[model samples]
Target: MQESDGPAPTSFPRPPNLLDGSRTSLRQILWALVFALTLPAVLIATAGFRSGYRAERETSDRRLQETARALSLSLDREIEKNEMVLRVLALSPAIAQGDFAAFHRQAREVGLASQSRIALIDMDGRVLLNTRTTYGAPLPDNWRESVLRKMQETHKAQLSDLHADPITGQALITIDLPVVIDAKVAYILSAAIGPEIFQRIIADQRVDRDWNAAVLDRSGRIVARSRSPAEFIGQLANPNIRDASAMSPEGNVQSVTLDGISVRAYFSKSPAYGWTFVVSVPVTELAASFQRSLFWLFILVGCILLGVLLAAILSRLIAKPVDRLVAAAQALGTGREVTGTTTRVLEFDTIQKALADAASDIRAQERHREEALARIAESEARLRLALHACHLGSWEYTPSTGAFEASSQCRAHFGQGPDGPFCYDDLIAGIHPEDRARQAEAVAQALDIRSGLEVEFRVVQPDHGERWIRISGRVRSGTDGDLSLVGVSQDITEQRLADERQGLLLHELNHRVKNTLATVQSVATMTRRAAEQGDEGAWDAFMGRVQGLAKTHDLLTATQWQGASLEDVLRSELDPYQDAMRQRIRLRGPRVNLQPGAVLALGLAIHELATNATKYGSLTLPEGRVSVMWAVALSLSPPVLIVEWVESGGPPVTPPRRQGFGTRLIQRGLAQQLGGEIKLDFQPEGIRCVITFPVKAVLAEPAPAEDSAERYAS
Candidate 1:
């Protein structure tokens, strides 16, 4: 056998056509019409049932809410009326004058008329008198200490939590009022009423027979119930009712009763006493109305079924001719010969001839489709090559399947093998650990908002180290109507690094120029002062100060102006003096670092001190000596820098007649510029100078800028 020049031809099973081997008889089409009509009938029935149920539920809920609100108002009015009775009794002169017998008789008369028990208690919570019993008959133990405390604290009348009377064991709620005598709580007058009073108020609201009404205290205890006041009073209310009551001052909830029957409950909370009034109606009542609507729907559907049966008989005659034409079309689609088949209907005959002509046209189009597919494949190859050359990668994500498809270049950029399957998790795994969360969050937010995604993150490639990559994409709909994320990722590592470097250089340059200008300004001012004094050597001294500044600048530049070593700064200024004096000069102490600003100030100060020692103080004689020492005071908060300059073994020192340019520079200019203190003492033996300033200002470094890449790029 000869070897093939191209890959061997492969055969694929043909996909099933939707219309192949499928036929719909005339009878089926007629039945389909009948069923289509039946669909609306069923929908109408469902809509009617839903409409009726919703209306009934809404009406019931509205009525229940109204009833609850009405009952609350009635209860508040009754309580207010009783409070008025207590208020009137409190103002009686007998109560304020401490005439217990007279106040008791007056309170007893008012309590009997209102059908409530009244009592007087002192501020210490001791019962002073009870209308039900004799005056001070071995007063009962204080049962409502919390209520009494509230009355005294608020200095107003308030309702108490539901409690049972100790003597009669009947459920009762109290209204406690603080009796104020000259701004002091002299006594508390309490009015205790039974739960029956609230039950009567609820009953008088004219609630419907199907509805049940209840009143609950702030503690969620059933103070009274219209249906069974004697049984449910003083008991904790239903949990669902308590929760619904707590959620809103007025609202409705669907809950099941204690008997397990579903009901709609509406509630309103009283603002005055913190009580909740509830009204419940059974769901079965609403369902009863819906059943009537459903019955009519069934009757209408039965009539439609009878009409469909008559149409089914007529469909057989029409189905034979169309069925023959359908078979011919199916056969023609499959490339089978449809030799002598015929239909009696004119429409069917016309369709058969048109399908035959279409079959011929389809054969010609198939050839063009194959050629287009070849061009598409070639274009994809060119795109891959272009992407690789530009250090760019292409990727697509299918949300429906959570599958990720990436080009070979994309896989390579992320340090994954080209043949390995790529997924969302795999892509995230290649991101730098510090940037992974931020990158993931950006993608998640884009997906949530259904918008375009643009993010930059670092990827740590196994072979190439870390690289910055920028990705940009947008959400689009595919041919099959599924959402897809398509985007390009470009390597930006080189650009980012270049920008960072440029920013660092710019910042250093700016800092150095500004500092140098400030130093020159100070030098010019001091030079002018010396010249004004008519010093013969002022020109030479000014030149020396400028030269000292230049030496310190060179040292700072070596470290990019981060800082200079204290030893380096001192040696730069003192090196010449030490060379001439040799063993007579001494330098000592721990090493330290000085910032750029401090270096300039200290350098000039050291030069001036060294010049003075050489001219008059220590270095004038062969036996004269100068010692320079510096140390960091680490014990202080933020630390401190201390330097001492001492000179000895020369002629006795005397104070200057008046301040010169050098003395003023050392005392004011150096101290102000360095944010430090300097002391110069003309001791008889020599000159001693001490300088101290915070180390943080001298040694502190500037923080690196965020987004330094942009600065460098600019």
Candidate 2:
């Protein structure tokens, strides 16, 4: 279905209704009532029958389990009593002393005096004496080792399952008790009894007529069967009993297939012997009672359904006015009102009249909404005009729903789809990565505080490539009780580029100003020192220093205040003096790129240091050496620019209290402009000035290899 902006248009004709007014169709109403009433009744009856059957099956299983438990407990008591009796007899002094002859006579009088079969066996399980003449033969293999091991290790009574005697072939269980003398096993007293003695106890149980009970041995083999013949004995039932026997010796039920029919098996285990007793009953038989219960349940359900049908018919007659009111309200929701659709049913007809009134009220509200939409359209038009003038576009975002909408210029700014406005995510993706994190953080903080955010960031445009834009946004509470972000964005590309160009020009101007200051300082130093000289010997030296200063300033002017090469400055300044001599100088340092401020400061400082050396230090003699080397010390507290103007093989040097303008300029002027500490040491050896400054303040450029060689050659 197409989502209509408002109510649907009523262009199509309405379909004709067969039943109208009070003359409703009897056939249709009757059919609808019958289906509504009987469909649920039938389903409920079926569900009730299933629930009853399951409940009965579970109850029957519980009953059978109870019967198995009772049988297992009774059997345990009987076996325990017999085993206890034998154990007590085995501990007799006559038996523990291995006085088998005395034990045999006493065993016959005490144990075998009745129908019980008793015997006295040695530690090796050799039947040395027997009360019954039937057990006169040697012990069998099955009983001999078991009896000996029980006496030696456990020193407790062991009750064996019903087994056929080797000699008499009589079914009996043997109870063997160990005789311990001074904590050492000496003999075993054995007693055999008919299994019918234990069966009599199980047969006396008052179990249900359908339930059959049986006692199982330690290995899950049936030892005794009640309500059945011996044919069913010595057989295993469900394996769940055997599996649970080692862990849990208690009553439980298991599902099994018995006699080709599914049956629930209930079982219990003997705590004394680790044997499981199981009882199984057919589920079909158990469900008989539930089947009879469902019969009455269906009858009760039918009567209730008949009453509900009559009630539905009466309720429909009574609720005619309510139905009309509901229909009237539905019409209003669809932007239509039904007039005079009222009834005479007391309370219901009053509601119908209210619905008619409500429909009228809705039409008034709709007119107001239409008028508001008109005003919104006008405002939006004016906003668009203003946005166009400023090259700006507006947008709104609802964070709770992640919904967003933007204007035409916003999409054009980021080069998004022309037909559709740019999504908020698309706009975010256009932000430059360097500035995206800060812009995103500002947006998030504004959303949290319900305030406004204004930020500028670079946007990757489609046709124009990268352009900077300023976004202004405010978070407001919307009508839906959720925060909505509404914002406007304007392109600031040209303004940002203008700012960058202005910054570059200012930087260049600052470099030119500093270089000009250095030239003035050099010219002043040359004139002052020339006037102070007392001899013509110093006049050439003063002219050379002025030339070095002029050479460095020429390099600065050529670069237009941007930067200059350190090697070019050094070679130009030294060439005038070096051309007359066939001598050389060595210069070494990193090819450093410098800013304009550092360029002028170092140029003048190097000129002064070299001039002083040529006058009175190493450069005064032809055999003297002038090595100019500069390096960047990265491991300093702050990185520093270090230049060494070492003069060797000349007259001895001494410290001077009064410094010339040249010395003062290299110490204070360089230190002040470069923002670093400077030290000038005038030792007897040479003049060493170490300058420590931040890397930013140094004006350095890569020194050409040819320029460095020329400094030495000339």
| CA RMSD per model (angstroms) | 31.8, 39.6
Model 2: colliding residue pairs? 593-700, 594-699, 594-700, 595-699, 598-699
lDDT per residue, candidate 2, 488-562, as tens digits?
A: 988888898899989998997787668576666665665566567643544565565556556666777787656
Q: In model 2, state the lDDT of residue 188.
A: 72
Clashing pairs in 1: 502-712, 503-712
1-714 in candidate 1: lDDT tens per residue? 997789878876653333344455446667888889878877877787778777876786787788788677666656766665565566566877889998888787653334478889987778888887887688775677887778877667888778877878877888888886754678898888877788777777776777678888998898877776777788887788899888888888888755466887888988657788988878787677678667866776677677677677667766776677766665655543333355443445445654765577686889899889989988987987788778788999877888898877778778889898789888988999999888878777777788998999999998759988898888878888888889988888889999999998999789779878877887788788778878888888888888988998998889887778777888888878775435666665444667777888788888889888988989898788887755554433445666778888899999999877877777665677667878677877779887877766676443222222011100
Count of clashes, each model: 2, 5
Give the poorly placed runs of model 2, Cα more than 4 Å off.
Answer: 1-52, 91-116, 124-143, 235-262, 305-714
* lDDT (0 to 1) per candidate: 0.75, 0.66
The candidate that wins on TM-score is 1
Angstrom error of the Cα, residue 172, model 2: value is: 2.3
- Candidate 1: worst 10 consecutive residues by lDDT? 705-714
